[model samples]
Target: MATALSEEELDNEDYYSLLNVRREASSEELKAAYRRLCMLYHPDKHRDPELKSQAERLFNLVHQAYEVLSDPQTRAIYDIYGKRGLEMEGWEVVERRRTPAEIREEFERLQREREERRLQQRTNPKFSSRGIRPGLTTVLARNLDKNTVGYLQWRWGIQSAMNTSIVRDTKTSHFTVALQLGIPHSFALISYQHKFQDDDQTRVKGSLKAGFFGTVVEYGAERKISRHSVLGAAVSVGVPQGVSLKVKLNRASQTYFFPIHLTDQLLPSAMFYATVGPLVVYFAMHRLIIKPYLRAQKEKELEKQRESAATDVLQKKQEAESAVRLMQESVRRIIEAEESRMGLIIVNAWYGKFVNDKSRKSEKVKVIDVTVPLQCLVKDSKLILTEASKAGLPGFYDPCVGEEKNLKVLYQFRGVLHQVMVLDSEALRIPKQSHRIDTDG
Candidate 1:
């Protein structure tokens, strides 16, 4: 049965009814609806080349709507406020068109700012973003003739990333390197730090040798945790490797200082926290933006290395075509396997969050991205459905507990029509439920 259209959908027309779903539907209902419509309207499943683009646009809209409304909170906000809530919340929503002149001006301004920061650091070394006098600061004092003498050593190891704190009161170059020296027995340490490449991302940093000759390095990745906030984690190594950890917390803020605009600052009360098993500690706040473009460049170089491997293999005089093929296949598998090792969303993503702490949540996401291989999609849906129905065939699980769900399979079974849904926890198999599906040209 077709669902009723809401007031907003009625006014918008244009398949808007097909996009927004009823808020009261269960998770399974929503998923079923999405999977059904996606397969039915998928442009790739159609042959009329002219209709392909139009179908693609509609598919994208439906997919986007499902992504938002499938989540409870986002659906509520959209229902009450429509697109306005998304805009105010900094969502990746469409914006009003900007004039050509305005667009050019914005780009120019960004370029100028980048150049200015680069020049400023070169000329005035001490003018750090964190507002600290660069260079070394030390003190030598004697106790009131107490038959002993005392001295103090204080050094501000300012380089780049650390030169500016999150407080906006400082200016940072890209990275920061620092070293300190005081009393040989106690005051000596070395430290290094860097921030994330993206502003809406997390900051990573580390410090070690602590007093004058310690080494520290850290890496951080950003993820959206909730509507109003973002979260991330970092791994580090150094002199204080197991002892010291830096916590960076940043928040967004906007004010009417001049023309309307948006900006973010490190909250004054922002807490810097770190824990060593049972211990917990906190410090005051600060801010800065790290760049990731450099990392992408390095990855490109790695790609070149992979491409060059085949040439190296070919150089062997005894090499055979079979050996070359085997090497290539092995390399492909290695690259895919590495995804699970790095805990990223690529090769091993189908394993459902192998490295994630929350297994259930990750598994649900992974299921959505597992497209049926093209070979299966070209056959009969009934056979595919029956095969997918096997319960203990491995790789299948009730990822979302308490929900009666089915895998809306779309694949080939014996070179015939294949599109079906099945419920099999051990092996999600699908069988043709109706004769409506068409898997031919």
Candidate 2:
């Protein structure tokens, strides 16, 4: 029920839809869209009172969406947590850096917790709703100064108990000491973890737990053998229950548990999730979610890096423009010569990053018309660029700076429309029938 509400809330409002723009639209794109919409719906532009009022409303909405989505900070929150995030309180404190998916996860968790509390309120007295988890729900209270939290828990049908724990969280490990009453069976756990990389790409862990029932010690080591799966083994010993070993093969949230008893007295048990229990869950989550989130974050970082180097890129673009200016006279001569005798005429040429999709892209996409440069390169009704980067050419620039590039050409060979796309580091040979854009060859 809570999950459904959260999903519904997520789909509620979209700023991109209001702006009639893609979510990936840049700041310049947002401004252009806002201006265009503003011009079309300026209220004063309409003569009829009803039409003016309607335009006013639309203009207000467009302005509001533009205001929220234009600011970088608010836009980031809007992108991650939706429109409500812009109005939410805790989000104001942007102290910690988090990914979009991470922020969404936190926001959803808070919403779920809030829903749980709401359910708690309308239930037990009227018994209308039983909360989310069905059991004794969640956190009763917490003292942040002392780093302690209290919990009331219920088991089976009627078993009830309560406990309070003070926690210590550090960079490397977590320690918690809990005190319980009412038929208390004192329990404690200690874990050790060693990591090879700073980001914890490879790790080994061991833990010991002691309770009224028995004392159990577990030892395990896990390594990520592939992007999707982790290879790990754990050996555990319990005083009364005996010893067992487990081999865990976990990949993309699919869990495999194998438990093999080391002692004959212990008997054969399930093969998975021994002491490697929590670790398997971690890897499953990392593979299924964390990988994609990290990849997206990396792309964002690269974009930011590119933005920071805009000055250098701009300078290079100026140089390329100057080179193009120098070749304009020769290019015009080539075009006239081609048109005079039905030779290949460079109709239009764009050099830079391009998408594979057939839909029209934003005007702000990193692309520049290199028609002049390309026209000058044409010879004998054919244009052939060498097997090297075109960026080093006299009249070409790396429009996208640090990104892969493509050369899209629309040319008329024997007065027929034809187009070809050539990759940045690949050779280009044109005037071929494969690039024809007409029914008649």
Q: Count the backbone clashes (under 3 Å) in each candidate.
A: 41, 6
lDDT of 2: 0.64
Candidate 1 residues lying further than 4 Å off, grouped into runs, are 1-110, 114-174, 179-200, 209-441
lDDT of each: 0.37, 0.64
TM-score of each: 0.21, 0.40
Cα lDDT of candidate 1 equals: 0.37
**lDDT of model 1, residue 374:** 15
lDDT of 1 by residue, 1-441 (tens): 112223342122122234323345567866866775576457786556645654565568668777766765555545545645545644333223443344455557776666545444432223222565455544433332212222333444553222211111123223333232223322223333344445444344343334344444444343332224444444344443332333333345421111111112222221123223112211111211122443454456545543444343233212222122222333354435434343111111121222246566555543432332211121222222222222111112222222234555443323344454444333332333362255354
Question: lDDT by residue for model 2 over 350-373, one digit each (tens)?
Answer: 887775556347534668888887
**CA RMSD of all predictions:** 24.2, 17.1
